[model samples]
Target: MIVSGKLLVSLSLLVLVFKVSHGQPLVPALIIFGDSVADVGNNNNRTTLVKANFPPYGRDFVNHQPTGRFCNGKLATDFTAEYLGFTSYPPAFLSQEATGMGILTGVNFASAASGYYNWTAQLWGAISLDQQLNYYNEYQSIVVNMVGEAEANAIFSGAIHLLSAGTSDFIQNYYINPFLRGYTPDQFSEILMRSYSSFIQKLYGLGARRIGVTNLPPIGCLPASITLFGSGSNQWNIKLNQDAILFNNKLNNTSQTLQKSLPGLKLVVFDIYQPLLDMITNPSDNGFFESRRACCGTGTFETSVLCNSRSVGTCNNATGYVFWDGFHPSEAANEVLAGDLLAQGIDLIS
Candidate 1:
């Protein structure tokens, strides 16, 4: 007898509820790795131009203090932590809080402008994916020392590991870099896929059982992409969107294959593309008034250093805007995205 997808999901959720009801935390922790979308403040101390630990970046966060998050407030991962009953969001691995008892919940190793390819991050002076994994290895040792081996093992195996990358690989490196342009988009995505598979396998080796990877968002719809590739027509770049779709398709297929081959691996590919595209295509339906541009600066192409306290024409509020800057989603948008992500990734916790 075959079970319907909806029934499988419902049964998985029931198991999750049972675990929680029995006093086990929904998941022991949440471990994060990837690019700017998941980076809390890892880039703040790094020698990278992609840093966002300044005014107007975290204007909606606690005390309105910038925490190096690309958004005006929390990211989708931050909301995921809240949904998982984590009182305090996981600390960045490079931050002061990633010490004794502080990192018991988990740690964020994501860096802005980083991608699956080391060169992609190297070009921007951001931490590479390999480097992020190295940091995770270091974090694992620290956790072992703090909590003893058995508990540490439990946390490592039980935590939900999240990865959100790929956008920067194409937008920040492949498309613009002359040397990388030698390879077709398919060839480049294959390279990225190899890196992705390696990273997941390494994480699995490090004891991560539950993993959730976010697929690429609508790249062509990003204000910066439109500005750079839309021929000044203020429209989505068709080729770039197609590239995103191609990468996402590969990501979904690879995730299925990994789940089948890897023992006890609960891998889920969260579809960030469609939810974001829906908001961009019909902003009013999602209670968002602006989706074509961002809330910062001119809202067309401003991001990172270009989006600052001195940015002219910056909106006072970002609640109605889908994007906070040229590349990252606003807090309101992240909240909506998080709901969708949790719904899709419930099986990971189960």
Candidate 2:
């Protein structure tokens, strides 16, 4: 007997729910590394302009406290943690909560404005990918000291590691920097792929088996992207979107190769591009009222410091909007994206 794809998915979800309800989490931990999208509050203490630990940013979060997450509330990763049955979200590696028992669940090493290239992070004073890995190594040592090598290894091998980047590479660096203009989009994507491959190999060496990497979203549809590259037009920039597609394709292909080469590596490439693009192009279908502009300030291009409580015309409620700021999605949109991610990344936990 043959079963429909939808039915198979439903059955799988049922199994996951059964496991979680039995007090057995799908994974031991939810380790995260990436850019602002996955960052919980890694950049909060850093003297960088890419911070979001302020009002109007976390206005809808728990206790309405901005935790340096770029979104108005929880990020997609936060929802992923919930689905995986983790009672507490991973604390930022730089935060005080990263010490001792606080890191038993997991830790986030993501930084805002960071990319595959170290120079990209240097441009904005954000932590580089290399440095994030180094911190992870240190975290492993601390965990070993607390729980011995055997228990620590169990956590490392059983945990799900998530990596999210690339969007900032193009939007913040390649597209804007004059020095990087020499390399074509394809060449730049190749460079990023190399970095991605290296990062995965090093992570595997550190005993990470289950890995989920988020591909690029629709870069052209972002409020900040449109404002910066739209040439004063109220339309999404197709060029930047094409670049994102190119990079995502490379990411898919590279992930396949890495999985084939590395034994026991469960590398799943989470596609955020089409899901987010659908919401932007067909907002009504996704329960969103506004897609063209963000919910903050004028909605065209206000983020970070510009998207403050004092910003004029900031929307009172963000539930009806697809985006909370110029560069990040609202909590409502993040929920939808998270659902899609969990479905796509079922293998990571299974």
Best by TM-score: 2
Q: Estimate each model's TM-score.
A: 0.95, 0.98
lDDT on C-alpha atoms for all candidate structures: 0.92, 0.92
- Candidate 1, 1-350: lDDT as tens digits: 99998888778767765655666468889999999999999999888899899989999999999998999999999999887877789999999878777689889999999999999999999999999999999999988888799999999999999999999999999989999868999999999999999999999999999999999999999998999999989999989999999999999888888899999999999999999999999999999999988999999988889999999999988999999999999999999999889789977875
TM-score, model 2 to reference? 0.98
Runs off by more than 4 Å, candidate 1: 1-24
Clashing pairs in 2: none
